[model samples]
Target: MNLRTLILLLIMVAIAALAVLNWPLLATPTTMSLGLTTVQAPLGLIMLALTALMAAMFLAYVLGLHGSVLLEARRHAKEMTAQRELADKAEASRFTELRSFLDVQHSAMLARMDALEARMSNRLKESDNSTAAYVGQLEDQLQRQGGSGSGGVQELRIEPGLRP
Candidate 1:
């Protein structure tokens, strides 16, 4: 098995051997002194029994502590997993909301661009119409001036009469 189990097993085996070796002493009855009395007992046996009892109690305590630690660790792991899931969900939701917001902003920008293009187109058309009208007026003015010259070479005059 593992190192801990191996060491524990070796310690138990050594203690058992020690107990077995003292079996003869354990069987022999002896007198023990009290405050005001004396009693005949197997001191070795009593000592061994007390040692065994103490060992059992210590082992139980250690096992109980280990079990509590293991359960606490499991509980913490579960809470961490739940917290991680919640965080992941929150992050994903934020991403989804951000994407939706970007999409709406993108559509609004496109619509604004379309409106700007339409306005630019109308301005260009208006500019072209005004230019054509000016050109027609210039042609009529040239015709009227040339009509008086009868196709002869004439000196052109400069004028500043163009106004809106």
Candidate 2:
């Protein structure tokens, strides 16, 4: 089904094929002649069966190893996925909290700006009234000194750093 399983299956098939192909070589008989003795025996089907059995056992062992590895990998992947989900949730929560804090700060800054603007407007109005009153007082003093006939100008000398 999975890649690992497929590979294991393929290996088993190859081993079986090799065993069948080598069957004739394993099943043949041989003779050994020493100087004073001669021995002969039939190996044939017995050797072939043993070789095939060993190959089958080996294939089984490899398949078991592959299955174990696949299981471990699947388990590790699940754990990592869960860890990533938790991290993402934590990051989202932190961002939401920061956004709320910034929103409150923005509102406070706007309110302070509005109050400052109002205070500046009142100060400017007071300054304008004071300037108008001072101008009127100067005109009245000029009229009392002479009705514009006596050159209603007075000059006063001042030292530096003295306020008039």
Candidate 3:
């Protein structure tokens, strides 16, 4: 047991031993004065009884205080549990909102990539068409100049398989 409890138990044992050892003296009647009257009683026994009553009262008070504290702690625990649940729900909502925002952003990014790809493809096609037109014009000029070969104009032939 704790030191304080052990000490209290020893003190109670000593008081009981003292009362038992002096039983005759404790039982001897003596006159005691009250505020309004006087009475002949065993003063030692009366004092012992009063001491026991006070001890019992103090013990009752201690037990009551301990019980009340336990109840308060239980209430606090319940409140803490509720608060924790609320915080968790709020966190989950934030996560859900974040997920939805990310989804929208991801979709927009994909759409932008697709549009850029389509524009790049259109530009490539236009460049190929322009290159073909230039090649065709060069061939036509070379064919017309070939009719006057006396001027020593060399024939220019572009390879069909080559691309700029």
Candidate 4:
């Protein structure tokens, strides 16, 4: 049981014990003057009964309050649980959207990289062809000039660290 219930039960038990203990005293008669005449009655029993009735009423009130509080707490917990579920769903949707977006971007980047690589390869091939053509043209010119021999065509050469 909860602390509140346990405490209330203890209070009720104490009240019952007190009532039982004072049973003999409650049976005796006493007199009180109510401004006009004095009447004899079992004053202890009446007082005890009244006190017990008040205690019962107070306990009832406490129980009613506790019930109300427990109900409100349960309601609040339910609302929080629903809100948490909603937030989690929203987060999941956001992640899904983000994942899709990233996938699209990744594919686009890969395609662009592939195109760039192809272009670079083509350019390198063209450069190599051009260089080979230039070298072939130089060799053809040299052969033609060498074959025309007009005094064997003395070719002039320049060397590093030498100046004319």
Cα shift from native, residue 70, model 4 (Å)? 1.8
The ten-residue window of minimal lDDT in model 3 covers: 155-164
lDDT of 3 by residue, 79-156 (tens): 999999999999999999999999999999999999999999998997888688777868787777877666776767
Please give the CA lDDT of all the candidate structures. Answer: 0.87, 0.77, 0.91, 0.83
Q: Residue 33 deviation, candidate 1, in Å? A: 4.1
Q: Which regions of candidate 3 fall more than 4 Å away from where they truly are?
A: 1-3, 130-164
Error of 2 at 65 (Å): 2.0
lDDT of 1 by residue, 103-156 (tens): 999999999999999999998988787777678777777888887777765555
Tell me the spans in candidate 4 whose CA falls farther than 4 Å from its real position.
1-22, 31-40, 149-164
In model 4, which range of ten residues has the least summed lDDT?
155-164
Q: Which candidate's lDDT is highest? A: 3
lDDT of 2 by residue, 23-133 (tens): 766556777565799767445565556766887898899899999999999999999999999999999999999999999999999999999999999988877867666
| Worst ten in a row by lDDT for model 1 | 155-164
Q: Give the TM-score comparing model 2 with the true structure, all chains together.
A: 0.62
Q: Which candidate model has the greater TM-score, 2 or 3?
A: 3
True lDDT of residue 100, candidate 1? 100
Runs of candidate 2 with Cα error greater than 4 angstroms are 1-44, 146-149, 155-164
